[model samples]
Target: MVALSNVRFGKRNDEVKAIQAGLIAVGMNIPAGATGFFGEQTRSAYAAWQRVLGFTGSAADGFPGCSSLAELGARAGFVVDCRNPGAITKSSVRFSRNSGVAVDEATARAFAEQACDRTGAPRSWVTGVSNGANLLTLVFRESSFRPNAVNRDDVNATGPIQSDGARLNCSRGYAQVIPDTFAENHQAGTSDRIYDPVANIAAAINYIWRRYGDISRVQQANPHRDPAPY
Candidate 1:
């Protein structure tokens, strides 16, 4: 079985190798031949497979979605696990309010860039704002670039307060993720603390990838759209 989480871009592991083998088996050309590294060649091949599977536009953009990856695995004789243990229902989170001092745009961009790097998401998400899709905009809307921001009145506010003075499950940090969300989606090498800017943003990015497939599809990440729960 292959976990969908290990099949993203920039990942290097046995699962990526298995995915490459599957793609190659399906007549997608991966010249490196199951190298266990997911680079441009593998992404291009995966995108081709997506096209073969009738996905178009951004849906065929090489980032593996559960359905597409699972189909590939089915053909390759491997089971795909699409479960996201970190996922929390939108009903459990409320975009109540932001609390904490706001940081400047430059600082927020820097943090977001670091998060993109950690999560293997495109840095363009932070550096560029095409089609109103921008990570900075999402951070600004969620917490106004506040690294320590907390939303205390939401449904997730039931736990005892922590060192940051907010309840344990209250949304916190630049992306305002709850502690459980942060713990489940935390990047491998990042600080465990939810208040850490890069860690928080990275977890949010991973969660976005798992839930929405891409940041552009998230309403909160698009400046032109009304702020919505993601």
Candidate 2:
């Protein structure tokens, strides 16, 4: 499963090395420095980054994944031009519109599509739901999802779908995944497990299925309370 490919697969050989170097510079990673080969050491380094950041799920393998890059970019404030990506921090949306990194709607949609496709969810629905909204890639922003891959960068995390960096983990891509008590309840279908994005997306669709069956019930159940600020 870790062998899957995304845009990150097309990174130039030097870009791959730069990622390793950046991870190492932050002191939480020690991959062979992106020898242009995504091997175990790189994977371990990524896992280390997750652990440092306190991501909830498994460690990040050194496959040069977009989620990893996007999260790190968010942490580093790529879009907005911030500095330093710790496991957690007290920065605002660091990513700026000027960051050399790409931050366009089309890119966001592609990433969201990739996430949906991999999770086996309906890309059409996900895209429709997130359309035109401020979107960002969910990378290592979630503490619950970051612990295993944080390396030694002294990164920190808040809770599920929580972070204090660039808001790029906006409500768009997989990074914006939100799981509530209702999600947990509906997950009884052996679908979209909240913890696993793949399962969560599937579960999300199933969760929305209630609209036809019991949608009104769901809306009535959870009061419209604004989520806590990140």
Candidate 3:
């Protein structure tokens, strides 16, 4: 079985090779063939596959979504594990406005871009569901760009006090995620500390991908819409 996380852009692994093989099996051209690297050639081939699957415009931009990737895995005799550990019922998560010491927009954008790189999300230039700008907006709405922001009065604010002087379950960091959410969606190779800007943003991005499909669907991430719980 191939994990969906391993099949995105910038990722290089056996799962990428499997995806390349699948693309080849379906007659998509890859000059380098199954190189295990998800570069321009693999992206183009995947775009072709996406087109064949009836996706167009931004959907066929070669970035793998769970449904499309799963379909490819099925056609290639493999199973895709699209399981999302960050899956949480929206109703169970209450929203509250919280703020802390703020950073400039440029610093926040830099952190958000790092998160995009780690999570296979596109930067601002890419037109798609979730991009770096979307993440920046979400982070701003959630914590006002504060990496150490914490919401101690929200519904998730129960539990023992943590090292950061907040309850263990309080929404913390730039993305305002509770401890459980952070732990569940934490990106590999990132710090376990919930206050780390890049790690917090990456976890939030992964959670967004699983829960809402993309940041575009999140009201807080949309500039024109009134900020709401995501």
What is the per-residue lDDT of model 2 for residues 38-91, given as tens digits with 9 covering 90 to 100? 455665676677666664342333333335555655554342211111112223
Q: How many clashes in each structure? A: 0, 45, 0
List where candidate 2 sits over 4 angstroms from the true fold. Answer: 1-12, 57-67, 74-230
Query: What residue runs in model 3 are displaced by over 4 Å at the alpha carbon?
Result: 8-76, 83-102, 125-133
lDDT rank, highest first?
Answer: 1, 3, 2
Higher-scoring candidate on TM-score, 1 or 3: 1
Candidates' C-alpha lDDT: 0.80, 0.35, 0.75
Tens digit per residue, CA lDDT, model 3, 1-230: 88876676667899999999999998999999999999989989988988999988766777677888889988998899876544443323333323453586788888788888877777751223443337767788898877778898988889776555777678888888876787777777776667778778888888776655446556778776788888
Error of 3 at 178 (Å): 1.3
Ten contiguous residues with the weakest lDDT in model 3: 89-98
- Candidate RMSDs in Å, in order, are 5.2, 18.4, 6.3
Worst 10-residue lDDT window, candidate 1: 89-98
Q: What does candidate 1 score on TM?
A: 0.72
